[model samples]
Target chain A: MTDAIQDEIIREFDGLEWLDKYGLLIASAKKLEPMDEDSRTDENSISGCQSKVWIQSYKRDGKLNFNLDSDAMITKGIMALLLRVVNNRYPQEIANINLYFIEEIGLKSNLSPARSNGLESIIKRIKEIAKNEALKDNV
Target chain B: MTGFAKDFPILEQKVYGKQLVYLDNAATTQKPNSVIDTISDFYRTDYSNIHRGVHYLSERSSERYEEARKKISDFIGARNPGEVTFTAGTTDSINQVARSLEPSLKGNEVLVTGVEHHSNIVPWQMAGAKPRAIEMDEDCNLLLDSIDITKKTKLIAISHVSNVLGSVNDIKKITEIAKDHDVPVLVDAAQSIQHLPLDVKDIGCDFLAASGHKMYASTGVGVLYTSDRFSDLMPAKGGGGMVDKVSLEKTTYQEPPLRYEAGTPHIAGAISMGAAIDYMQKIGLDKIEKHESDVYSYARDRLLEMDNVTVYGNTDRMCGSISFNMDQIHHYDAGLIMDKMGVAVRTGHHCAQPLMKSFAIEGTVRASFALYNTKEDVDRLIEGIEKVEMMYT
Candidate 1:
């Protein structure tokens, strides 16, 4: 189940020190494959972030894929954590999942309110993309 | 005074299983128990509408409120109590001047230093006046020689101490320059009032603005000091309390201080602010200044010792703040890490976006000190920063 992936992320973060959560996020971000420059358009951009961030979604064979990037390394790291849970998953599953890893890992507590707001925006954008993909399948 | 941190009840607490080390004084200071008690005592005992009430509570409240203004008048060394207007903090106070001075500006530019908070800059811009920033030196000190106070300059505004750089400006010298140009100067004393013994007369600035919450008082209260020459202006906002006589055709406004204060004033906030001032006066500004300078220098020296850290501002005359950034580390990330370590510091542009742009940085982690902050707090900040760097490695 997709919950298993979430559990694994929670366990990994829980084992790290309170400060190391950011480092883990940074490392996750660094490991993420870079998005194509063409995908860095306004449609793929996430607003309300202090740092410029981009997220693109595509549907292939009933599975949704997401590519996230940010000018800020920490933000990119945060997006990578989200991508780990929901990327290459079914549209409905990606849309329905709560992504509790954010709350469970104490990421929100570590980040400023503005950063959290941006994180929320990123999640919302991801869900929006997934929901649209589901709507396209129905059509 | 060595153990003065005990006076702040909030400082004794813990955050995330660690002892809280609050160094974000530039944002606002934690109130002392005396200030807290004064506010509660006012509401519990003598809560009433000020100025026009015939009842005993009203008389007592009115007397206490005016007395508080007098205390503030003395605190900043303003010659007349009437010259000091109670506002809803520094932003509101500065806006009052902006609105009042706009029509008189007649399209002239408002000269402000680059180091001002947005509260100092946006007001002038909002008043339909363009703000011309006096550039800072490469070292981030205000470049006085670069200040061109021409005939087109309607007003010159500067912070007595920069919230970002913690740089204490030579207000007396700037005021002298303003005098030569026949331009009135406004000093935003929000950062300086808590750390320095401010005498408006000594500085010779035409106007000064300060906030109460930044000086160990309750929020929603501040003072605007107006010189005798420009003391009275038309009311920016008109309401029941500010008017002397009102008819359908016309209304006559009250004097300088009352004219500016509209609606039911913050009686409790003012009284509590007076108590906060009393608290500082008892400790003595000279002693507080000395303690703050010592902490600032200690923190700056410690931060400078770290090879990766780039500390901002000239330490020679700075007070109560140490703003810096570590190499290859975002200020927001460092701030978050510091928060986890129970060291509260300010991050982001600190409402000085222009100043940040000038420095070619997005932001810096700012650790601003107060009377309650000790050398130990600075050590925690240093430790928190080290932890941030270590995490990235």
Candidate 2:
């Protein structure tokens, strides 16, 4: 897949050490907008994650935008990267986007069933929403 | 690395360009080279089913497996080898007891401490019984005097040591209380068996459950100690090996331990546990206890001295695990950063959510100790904490 954002992430993480990658992620997590109290309800929270996470989404100009936040800064940093790639995109486009930077950047542990970090669950949730929205658009 | 650390080959490597300071012993311990080789040797020399085959290999396998049982029986002061039955793990062991006593436990209460792992709490609940907690003070000491164990209380299930806080419960005292009431006690020793010298006879408990993987042995094997007094408690499971005679109309069962272990068992895993017991005994449990105490005290003292850290559970006696959190950093965030620094500490509820609820916190960062751990590892952990603080500042 040819994704400029993913390629940029890959390049940024290419020469860095493990600690440096975590440091960068912490910085990015700090930059991500914090979710408000009303939006961080039980309805928006993702289950089966060690760190608590909430997701909020809306439609704007025929595109879906998501706001994701986590109590753990490292997870929130990954959420920031995820939003940078998938947010502000049409539903059909998001349904087909391939995430390759996760493997390239040595964050594959986050994708494991054992860790259950909610990264995979959140991605699956995002895709499900995109597909459902796309079906509605067709109807 | 220290003298004992060299015995565990997994500890010899580097992680993220630093020596691996393994602080997650409460979750599972790294196996020694002796244990690894024993498992391999058993698999190569005697790989046959036990107690059924008449061949030489089967006889050898059965003898070795029985020897393993005997070693474990002696290790926990089981009085006789017939009192110990091998189950999958501690969770399985507890579930077995729950299944056997389900009829009686359906509506009765099983008194438990506030700081029990889900393994001890969930099994009784699954058996259709209510698990009421024995109240403790703010310092997490068990307040034994206040519990109202009327006719409704059938059992008292307790943990010898809390998996999260390393807080050792006064189980002997609890057992005495249970004895006065004629209520049976089941001790969950998953967190204590590896670190402390255990004697089920000395503790005077009816049942004790423990896991193998947590004690430097292979997974998929554990010991469940059942007092001879309850030998006739209906076997939790019934299959080929546990029965004396099977018939279309009725089936009679074997006596005690063999009656409990039905179907094919994890023979190699059992032998590996025996080897692990030998490995620990060779160095002596007293020596292991002394070394671990020094390291644990040093770690706890250093963590307590840090003004930004909040260490949990201040019981009179503690070991194995110490739970804490930084002033502003999330436990998960601290754990991830510490992993990068090659310090492997477990961060989360540690499978004790009720305890977490009592602490009024989501989770904690736990750095647990084992025999192989040293003051050097504690220093490295402190360094990792400092690095995390520096990055955030």
Candidate 3:
């Protein structure tokens, strides 16, 4: 079952070239203009970036919806690509998704060490949020 | 100038089929032939542990080791050889001072400038003293107006010249202010000792620390100069040669310097440092100082003439370093481009992260100079910067 889920994630990420296919998502994430506290997370709350990153998520119709922002151009593009797969998924579904599928797709080979670590950190945080939400639903 | 340049053997080596244009002197200066020969001679002829043996070789090694101490004392114009304590580098020396002096500084504040290198700032912070910062102006000069020398200020630590901005502070005046408030001052002279004429007495600083490698000497050797009056203060470490007598019950420590130097000293390092100082004296520090200042002035002026280039620090007052940025280019990218051109420059915070925070910049490309550097080197650096600006902008 885990292998099937991993294969699906690898296929999805492989279909998207990140910078070329989803250019709009990349642009929107890169040009993250300031918004009200209700619309965006505090800049101080942003984590795991050499530059600034702001991630805001809400539950819509019993599914998680994410609107992510980052000050760095390339990092924003990466976050946008990540959000495409995990956004608007059920909390349990998001928590169970495997990120190591990226390594099989050769994503880690092309990225610098710092960028790779940052991406891993962001993925871990997202998974943590999903697990918390799933636990709350069970309770 | 070419003859002097050839004296440094590293300059003769080709990097990627091009002659190396080394401008990373602030990180570490290339050793001349004389310094290399001095270390080789000591190891080849006389090799023994110092101050612990009664044999002929031991006596000779001990004399040379102690003579090196005297040479360092004279080089920095310290009052006595006893005032000079040997350490690994400026970082170690500053650590000693911070750890040893913190106990005496209870209920007192330690003032430092934002322009200090991490070595000078972090140790004091680790020592449990409240570290206050002196602000810098828009031009990166230390704003003396912001310094409030109150009685609570037990220690005032400042760098003589900023490693990133290359701005030389008036340490004498700053020390005078500290004196009026009855606070002792520690001057981090790692960058300034080579480019500026320094006299501990004239500056009136209570303690001064400098590295050997930054001033044409070998690595693993440095000096910490303390005033004789404050010799009674405790040292951070104690061991082998530092104590007069030792027993299981109690150990009595020696005088000021011996108390601070705990382990077996770097004998060959001390000898080569003396030789490096001899080479600098022969070339005349005044002449080298003027030469480096000229290089900085020429580079700063030429960099300002280029479009889409932003240079940090005051042009009118600087030593041998210039930090700048080309429009739309990351500092790491610029550094990579320069490296391909066989021009070396430091690309980072230059260990002054607080100063980078003040400028709201990630980092800047720094080109630092030395006595062996020539006008052609500066031109190569400028050309490389121009290439980076053209490529990015």
Candidate 4:
């Protein structure tokens, strides 16, 4: 399933120039579902990012849903790209899945390390949330 | 001079099929061939430890290193080479002073300008001193009137030029104020040294720090200049080469500069720094300063002409850097687009988060000029920014 998603993302970005990829990311950001103002709290905020980013997750019918936003357009766009691979996926699947889409799409090196680190943190936080949700299901 | 740009080899490259327009001089400068070759040549011919080895290589290397020190001393117009101590960089230099002087602080606070880089502020805080920031005007100019250097104030540290704003602070006046209060002043000259002709004697500050990398030299070498009075302070660190006589009970230490150097210094970096100073001398700082000022003003004027473009800094005082933002455009987005267009500008807070927060901005796209940069480069930046605006809008 992870491979399928990674392949889809790679296919989506294949043969696109750097500017085109950036435009697509920005377009994805424009299409992202806006999170409630109240949900954008410090608890959901991620540090070590040059731009401000917030991610919130909730469990629904054994699946975890994610919502993320960033103050900077590029950061928001990157977050939107990452979410396309993991959002609305099962907790166990999300907890176990390794998203290689960033590397496959050449985004791992294309963007600055700070933004890449932010992407990693977003993924890490999502996985952590999924892992917690999986444990709660067992309990 | 057309031949001047040829001195820097890295500027020859093309980025994304476009000739690279490097405007990130404030971050770190591309080294000229002379500085680069000096580093390599020193390693190839004269590589040895100084102050201890009795061998010929040691003596030659030591003499070269000391020669480098004398060059830097002359470069900054210091009273003597004894007043200059080589450190890793500006941050290391400031930390050494802050740590060494912390024990003697019989006061409640250390005063710093609000526009200081993190390097200047963090040291005083790390040394357990309460750092009170002197207020700046809305335009980010230091409000000299807001400075309250009271009896409780032990030290006043200020940036000679603001890293973000590129606004040259009145260090001489600030130093005089500190003098009237009998408080010592430390001037961080990291931003000013490259674009301005600096004379420590004229500045009249007790201490000053500057990095070599910012001035066309290799990294890992910087200078801490102290007046004769401040030179009496104890060494910041203790190590092998800095001692005169090592005893079981007590070890006699060397004097001020050597005392603070403490360990095996950055010999090649220091030598290369001297080469860099030589390069700057050959070009003449007065000429470089004027050229940069003209280029910066030209860029600022052109940028201001653009609709909804907001440029920062006091234009009358800016040396070689300009920070600006386009209407409703994120700095990172603009920076990314500019990068694609092969114009390297720094985006983000520029290690001046306090200054950014004061202006209620996340970051600004900073296009800083070097002596090698021409009006053509500024035009390229202006065109690239226009492209970014078009793409985003």
Candidate 5:
């Protein structure tokens, strides 16, 4: 399914060279709210990534909200993009949405198991969180 | 320095609209044209399973394989070709030693330096042995006089060069001490085989392990040099070609090198190693060592001169790799930006978690050098570091 936010991301990255893309990502990374040291504990840390990544989630106003942070700027930048597409969305909506922008923006290579970026692992964790939240809503 | 960059066809290419400056030689060295041609030529002509056939083609293939073994045997100064057994790589060779010496290594300790890579650390753990790091000072220099070998220290496995920090440990001194204690020592030469001239006999180590890929040859082939003292060690792996007499109740294995080689080996890869050795020899190891040392020192000096960068590990003699980090910058981020600038480097713990713990840091950006890399590559790396620092500012 076509997503408006995903399409917008693809358009934003269009016609940019590799260095420019990285520059944009670094800027987005800076825009993300800093994660506190207490919240960046081992429990919140995501393993299998080359960089240190932490994720937090909570339900607000019957919708799921998420926050993610990484020590690496490019990784945090990608997390910023991901939050724009899925934050504050209903659990059921998040569980079924396709993040095609990752592929369209020349980042699909980083999602492979071979690459140490752990982009796939982050996406999986997001889906798992959405499924659990959706199940709790049903209960 | 010789114009070796032209010999590697892959170095001429452009990455990200810039000249690719490869500084990840510690991970793997690029193969020369002679090595590449040797692999293809072997496949085109002498492509057959070795040591098991009796036909003309089999004889030719077996002859070529043994010839490669002889070349390798001489390259590392083995007493004879029989002392060297071809394995998959350095990890495989180390695991073979661990497996063959399982009876002695299990429940014992293997003394290692604080700067060993995981390949040297993990195999001993998998073999049911604990790895204890020898004492080293803050600069990551091994304090040989402070080495404590206990009764449980059955073996000492150390790396000749640190893959992450490029600290060259004095394995010869360790061997001398190990001899007095009657404890066998294993030298991991995966990082040293390409950059420095090595002699197993001169080093007096019981076992030495090195990889073909790291020495500008093909992957899937390596050498495990076992001293004649360990000739009777049990085979780590049991298979068809390695066996001599097999029955329902009894099985006997082949002798020395063939005894360790379990199945059909990488025939072409081994031949490629022969070509790589020939290529390096023709260029002269003395010349290669001098050139690489010059380039390596220049790189280290330039990185040290950078005010915003912190270089890791210091030693009187260092080569192959130099790890550094910029002020308030993550190594992964620097590596990503450097990749865009066509300066390929390695970032992370570099499979040396213990070393990382000693430094109390997550990781560092490692720029490893090879014979082909020149001062120009180091200049490119400095530029990449400048770009990262500017981005942060």
Candidate 6:
């Protein structure tokens, strides 16, 4: 996809009034098939979550593309939100984005500390994939 | 009775201009005036370092401190006071046993029950011991026949009474099974020590651990009772009074109890625990047990009468606590509704997440009782449960 198309997709999400409005974002993300066991052989396991979550990032024409899947529904929504911010960006742009900014988005603010930790784990997984890709290019 | 209630200063406080009915006794019993007074007196009048001191205050403090150990031994029917080692609480006591037994355990296998608290399970796992939880029968009693005790089985750690389910395990039978396999057993008596009459000799367990706070004593005080035959086991942390002789060259450690108690002990806690034990002794444990059983039966019968209410554990015999869930409301919501009605019940997994997972439940609201709790308190709790049901249904 072109930068304009990506910006349009990002704008559609940013234009949403409430988090619940992005149920389509969560549904589309969940609908994306999980990477098979053979594909998730290593470097895809997300820690701190009670359920299994795998995030696979691939470089398409020097831009990051992420495919995420999680067993938990809420966690899948969180992963979707994370992908909207970090996916389909250049390695440098992805690295510049601070993961802690999720608290400002106010997703699952009422969740227990344990659930919040799981959300952070998903964010960290996305960051790890970006960092690994960034390292491969010597950035 | 009002005067007795006032003796607990916490009870005197008003939450929204209403009295606090602390029904979460199985979690931790409230301190009485006598126990509190004993603690304050130790800190104010008799504050001194105990043991290995030549000063007058130290000697006096040491005498009083060690006397508390004797009192605990007598209270629990332990053969010798030397078997009683001071710990932070029940968790610390269980962890100590798990750590000290590492040398004796060659293989990874350790037997435990499904009803054990996380404190009892996690420590053994941390020691690299593989824990096999014995399955509970239809009545929620631990099925000893299901336990596959092999030569690799190093230890059997079980709870005397489950904090969540309030189901009492047959410790004597469990210990006997461990004995047949020549494996030692550690009993987590955090819940039972307060309500039940415990005799270490009769139970024949290698180790028994209990928290003083659960028995109306001060917090931060607990006891670990070990058999004399296994007294040579070393403690996890070692320093100070635990050693016999310490020099730049080498250090010699003391005997069983002293070797385990390393730092300057909780003198006030120890003394207050002695007072608490004495208080319980005066009331008679048999009477307390009978009264608690009657309370459990009454609560269970009343709770069972309500539609869409499920009570967990063996109804035929339960001790201090009753764990139950409402029709469709979350446990947290139920807890909030109960709190609003001035009825305090514990919500969530009661630190027994595995038990929750077994039943495929998120959590339960547990209403636990104590000696001070009356039938009227149970009636208030029933009313609160009804309110919770009405709100969700």
Query: Can you write out model 1's per-residue Cα lDDT over B254-364, one digit (the tens) per residue?
Result: 887888899998889999889999999999999999998888889988998999999887734888667898898878778877898999998878889988888889788
Q: Report every candidate's CA lDDT.
A: 0.86, 0.93, 0.79, 0.85, 0.93, 0.78
Q: Residue B332 in model 6: shift from native, Å?
A: 1.0
lDDT of 3 at B251: 89
Could you give candidate 1's per-residue lDDT for residues A21-104 as a string of tens digits?
767777887798888888888887877776668987777789998888876677888878788889889998888888777778
List, residue by residue over B1-393, the lDDT tens digit for candidate 5: 238988998998999999999999999999888999989988888788887788878988999999999999999999999999999999999999999998999999999988999999999999899999999999999999989999999999999999998989999999999999999999999999999999999999999999999999999999999999999999999987888999999999889899999988888889888999999999999999999999998988898898989999998789899999988889999999999999999999999999999999999999998889998888999999999888776
What lDDT score goes with residue A115 in model 4? Answer: 60
| Per-residue lDDT of B244 in model 6 | 87
TM-score of each model's chain B: 0.98, 0.99, 0.97, 0.97, 0.99, 0.96
TM-score of chain A of each: 0.87, 0.97, 0.66, 0.88, 0.98, 0.64
TM-scores, one per candidate: 0.94, 0.98, 0.78, 0.96, 0.99, 0.76
Q: What is the Cα-based lDDT of residue B223 in candidate 2? A: 89
What digit string (tens of lDDT, one per residue) describes model 3 on residues B1-393?
Answer: 384688899898776456789999889999999999989988988879988798988988888888889988988889999999989989988888888888865556788988889998788778877778887778877778668876667799989988998888888889888887888889999998888888998999999999999988889989899999789878788778889889999888898778888889888888888888889889998898888877778888888898778998782468867899878666755675577678989877888998899889978889998888888998999888876665432
Q: Over all chains combined, what TM-score does candidate 2 have? A: 0.98
Highest DockQ: which candidate?
2
Put down candidate 2 lDDT per residue, B1-393, tens digits, no spaces. 667998999999999898999999999999999999999999899989999899999999999999999999999999899999999999999999999999999988899989999999898999999999999998899998886788989999999999999999988988898899999999999999999999999999999999999999999999899999999999998887999999999999999789999999999989999999999999999999999899999999999999899999999889999999998898998998999899999999999999999989999999999999999899999999999898787
Docking class of 4: medium
* Runs with alpha carbons beyond 4 Å of true place in candidate 2: none
Candidate 4: tens digits of C-alpha lDDT, residues B262-282: 889999999989999899989
**Candidate 5 chain B lowest-lDDT run of ten:** B1-10
lDDT, residue B13, candidate 1: 89
Cα-based lDDT at residue B349, candidate 5: 95
Predicted candidate 3 versus true structure: per-residue lDDT over A1-139, tens digit per residue: 4455557646655655332322333354545544356655554345544545566678989898676655444456556666766887899989988666557655564244465226666777788889999998899
User: Comparing only chain A of model 4 with the true chain A, what is the TM-score?
Assistant: 0.88
Please give the RMSD to the true structure for each candidate, in Å. Answer: 2.4, 1.0, 6.0, 1.8, 1.1, 7.1
